[model samples]
Target chain A: MSFLEVRDLSVRLKGGGPLLRNVSLTVAAGEVRGLVGESGAGKSMIGKAILGILPRSVEISSGAIVLDGTDLLTLPPAMRRQRVGATCALIPQDPLTALNPSRRIGPQITDRLVDILGWKRAEAEARARALLHEVQIADPDRVLRQYPHELSGGMRQRILIASAFAAEPRLIVADEPTTALDVTVQKQILKLIAGLQARHGTALLFVTHDLGVVSKVCQSLSVLYSGKVVEDTDVARFFAGPAHPYSAALLAATPKYTDPTAGLNPVPEAVIAAVRAEVENG
Target chain B: MTLVRTLLLRLMTTAVTLFGVAVIVFFVIRVVPGNPVAMMLPPGATAEDVARLTALYGLDKSIPQQFVIWGAGVLHGDFGTSITLRQPVLALVLGRLPATLELSVLALVMAVLMGGAAALTGTRLRETRVEGGIDVANGMALSVPDFLWGLVLILVFGVLLPVFQISGRVTPSLHLPFVTNFYLVESLVRLRFDLTRDLLAHMFLPAFALAIPLAAIIGQLLKQSLKETMHLDYVTLARTQGYSEARVIWREALPNAILPTLTLVGVQFTFLIGGTVIIERLFSYEGLGNMAIDAVINRDLPLIQGIVILFAVIFTGVNLVVDLTYAALNPRLRHG
Candidate 1:
């Protein structure tokens, strides 16, 4: 069995129709799997559902999220809560908003260690400093004492990365972690995340809209279109050539640096309609 | 350095506000169609006596002159004398200030505690039948005015139940130490638990009556803000960090949600002071509000002007404190 398995997942709005349909995917131990899609493709929703943090209005109509042989959906809420951060963690997008503005960096980073793992205050502080250093943050002591608003956006994102890794979680769900960052900072943060994930031998479910990011960081990729996975294949195979029509359209739509004069190509209307019909019929 | 600059600027603003309040109060009380001398004199008093008394209180002078004289006197802590009470207006206001302060503080505390509890409970039960009930109850509370609540409380607790005294800060017979003249504190200082209990018994109805509407307003604001704050990214991040639901709600969401509520609390504090007039009258509790009402009725110009200026100062002071609190709670404001 894979380390994390999302089998036949379906999510629906409270009063509205389905938001995510029968989506299935898997991640082997220490492997980085990417979920690539446009906005409203239910990529973030899947990440939230796996972490059991979906908004109140959204419900998993049918699905089972299995982590380490345990069905997360079947566990009691308290047990699931305890499992979060210890067994699975998340590096959220929009780092500027992800950290609590009212809180200082150190306590926020060490909260899981102190609150969930019940570590000593001094020990947690030490580990927090070490985590910050591991994320390549200089002057960890000053960073810890400062509030979220006091730090730059990249610094805040780095701190979030450190916090996500503080518990040495078995799985990390990174949902567009570098989307809000500048180009230079984005590359550094992505490299840091990839390096840390590899060093810890941790599984990662990377969700992003940028196919370029997926090509660089993800080993295997799942191309999602309109709430459905149109293609699931190795990253190398996906980059070389796509198997599914929607996947080919997505690659075609992505802007290539090699062809500077080639203005972006919009996905054809017929392709989107076909993808939507496939999801509806299925 | 920024803190000092901010403090200095606030102090200058407060000074200007007080000066403006003094001028407005002095002129507005004079504009009202009532003569302090006419009210002071008995039925047999002569016109010359009225003139002399009017001149004595500086009412005979022009409005600007009267303002200047009153302003100068106020700067020296002299608010002239009350024509009806035949005491210094400052003395009369000071004597009653403690009672009003005590009542306002107690009412404010009650409002905060009650509102905070309601917000927590309502937010927890949001999207349920119970939340609907809480909303309806809050709506009803907010709709009823403070004085009406005071009358209802008097009818129930005072008349029907007879569980508490109908009026006054303490029983006339129970004279605890007069350390601060605040019955509760005086009782405590004197170590008289009996008097303390009596004071609380008398204070309950009035404070509760003043608190109900304010609590409803605060509770509704807090509930709405908390619901929104819970959906914020940081709150979700807290949950994913393995913090329990309680921690997410209180530690993560409450801090952000409570900022707006703090401003409301400051506003409601001024309401408490204003509401105390009717509340004190209903309970026959002698506080600044009751004194102001008497000053208005008796046409005591000095007393009325003095009370109005005092209230204005209080309102401005409360707002200043609220701004300072905002700075303390928000680091962005602190640095800016």
Candidate 2:
């Protein structure tokens, strides 16, 4: 079994049909796993389930999210939160709103460390300052006093990344972490995440609809469609030669900067047809 | 320059509008029939006495002359003698003002605390049937007028329990707690805790009546704002960041949700003034509402005008305070 293993995980929304259907995944120790899917394909849902942060409407009908030999689904919410902070963390999609707007950045970062990790305020604050510096934020002390709204989009994203890194979790979930940033900022954030994950040897579940994002950091990739994993492969195999038609289409759809003369590739008819059939069935 | 310009403009507009309304209300009062001097006179007085009374009361003057004299006196800080009290109107108002102020302030404090507590509970249980029931109860309580609620409260707390006095100002023997012994520097001041309870008991009818509508409106506002705040990206991130439900809703959600309610509080404060009239009459509690009604009935134009001006000033002051609070709660409005 992998270090963190999910088996037969399913989520059904209230008054709605299955959101995830028997989806399973594994993240070996210190490896980056990519989850690629369309907007409603339950990529984020999988991340939420792993962290035990599912919405009130959704129920884990049948699943076992085993992290380092413990069944996460069986733990109480408070215990689960402790586990999440010490063992795993989530980098949410939009940095612009990922932080509490009413609080200064430094206190926001230190609060979690003091409560969840039992780090004293001074130690936690020092850690926060160091994390900010690591994330390349200029004038870490100044940023500490400033509210979320005071920072630029790129700066906010960096701060969020530093927050996720602050606890030194064993596993981190970056769910479209840089999707809301500009292209240049997106590259910087991805590089930052990649570098941090490498240095700390923490497992990463990087969820994105864009295959290009996964290609940079993921050691392994899983392609999902209609709440099912359609393909699972190593990064080199997945990109160099994709097995699933959906995977191939996703890769083809992704724009390439090196080949500027190449026109955009239209989406594959097979994937489109499959998606249409799924939509029509519902 | 910028702040002063805006403040000047706002003051000018408010003053002009208040002046127009005051003048119209003044004329409307004058047009109504019963004479102040007549109300004052004994039944079998002579025609010469009535004439002398009219001249003495300044009722014999032309409308413009009367207005000029009244307005000039107001400018010079003189609110003429009251027809009923036969003392300077300002002195009478000032004397009675503290009583009304004490009642209004106490009732408002109770209303804020009760309405806030109820709103917190309601929003916390919004998904449950109990929350729905509480919401309906709030709406029903609010829909019934303050006088009716006051009567119901009086029946329950006053007649049935017999714990509280039915009608009166603070018991003359009762001294307020905490502030009585300022001379004792080292020790904490002695307090009559029972007196505090007694005061609150007396406040029950008026405060509950006032708080019902405020709570209903606040509950509705709170639920809407909480729902919106919960949907915001920050809240979602907080959840993923592992904040407990209470922390997420209270610390993260409630502060942002309170922005709209601050505006509502100002408008409701004005409503409270209007509501006091029926409540005071129903309970036979002496307050500004009762005084204003008496002045209107006796057709004491100067007293009515003075009371009206007092109310306008209070209403404007409440609005100014609310605006200042709005700037504090919402950063966008601060500089703007």
Candidate 3:
């Protein structure tokens, strides 16, 4: 069995349509997986479900999520939380949203290290400084002491990544970690994640809509469409020759830089024509 | 820091406007035209007696000179002699000042507790079906005037039960820190549980009355701000970080939401002092509000001017203190 195995996971929100339906995937130890989909395709929902961080109205209708061979669905909330912090950590999309705005960045990062990672205050502080430096943040000490608001968007994102790494969890689920950063910073953050994952041999569930990023970090990829996984395959094979029709259409949609003069390749006229038919039927 | 600057500018505007209000009130009182000489004289008194009295009281002096004399008296801590009380205005104001201070302080405590409890309950009840009922109660409490509440309280606690007195000296006062020397002295001489209850009882009605408006205002403010804070991204992040729901609310949401409430509390301090007039009169609780009332009714010009100016200064001072607190509690307001 994989280290973390999700079997037939389904999620539905009250008053909203099904967010995820019978989506199943697995992550082995030291493996990085990419869950890719268009917007509103339940990619983030899958990340949230694994962590038991769903919104109040959403329910996991049917699923068995086993972490380290223990069913995550069977454990109580408190136990689940303990496992989450100590075994897994989440890096949310926006750094500002992820960090407490009122707390100084250093204490915010170090406190998590001490509390969840069981590092002493001094050790945590030192680690926090080093982590900030590791993330390429300038004036690590000053940035650590400053509030999240005082730092630029990219700086805050780096600080968040440092805090996530402070936990040293077995698995890290990064939900659009690089979305809020600029192009330059995004690449840097991704490289940092890749380096960290390699150093620690940590499994990662990298959730994003950007296929280029998925191609960079992931060994396996799951393509979701309308609350279901349309394709799940090894990243190399899938990218080499996508078998699913939707996957083919998505790949075709990515603009080719080789032909700059050509208008961006639109999804094939046949695929669009089929979607229009489905909508018209309802 | 910019938020602090914005708050300071608003406070300064409030202070300047309050000064203008004080000046206008000063002039308007004098414009009422009946001479103190005519008002004080016996109906059968001869014209000579009236003329002599007018000169003695400086009623014959020009309005600006009278104002100057009144202002000087204010600066010198002499608000002239009260015609009705047959005492110096300063003495009367001071005598009643302590009582009003006690009432206002008690009311502030009560209001904070009441409003805080209501806000906490309302915040919790938001997801429950009973939220509408609690909202209605808050609205009702907010809509009713303070004096009317005092009257209702008197009827229930005073007129009916007759168990607790509706109004009088703060009964069986227990020592309060830094405020009442007598209570502190007594408490130090002998520590007793009975004294505490007596003090709490004495503070009950007026405090409850004063607290109604404050609590209503605070509860509404807290509930709205807390609701907004709950929606903030950090709260969601805290939950996702494997923190418990209670910890998320207390550690993350409460601290972030409380800054505005603290600022409002500081500003409310001044409003409480101002609002206590009707409360003091209704319960006959001696306080600054009561003193202001006596000054107005007795046409004690110097006393009225002094009380108004004092309140204006205190209000502005309280606002400045609140602004400083904002910088302390909210890092976003400070680090910038």
How much is the lDDT of residue B24 in candidate 1? 78
- Interface RMSD of candidate 2? 2.0
Error of 2 at B84 (Å): 0.6
Off by over 4 Å in 1: A263-265, B55-58
**Would you estimate the TM-scores of all the predictions?**
0.96, 0.92, 0.90
Q: In terms of DockQ, which candidate is strongest? A: 1
lDDT of 3 by residue, A55-142 (tens): 7788988888989999988998898987876788788898767778888887777765666567799998998888888888779888
Off by over 4 Å in 2: A271-282, B1-18, B44-46, B172-195
lDDT values for all models: 0.89, 0.79, 0.77
Could you give candidate 3's per-residue lDDT for residues B87-195 as a string of tens digits?
Answer: 7866666666666666777788788888887777777667675656667777988898777888888899887877666775446353444344344234445665466
lDDT of 2: 0.79
Candidate 2 structure quality by residue, lDDT tens digits, B91-126: 666655555565666667776776677667776676
- Chain A TM-score for predicted structure 3: 0.92
lDDT of 2 by residue, A25-73 (tens): 9999899999998899899999989987777789988889999899989
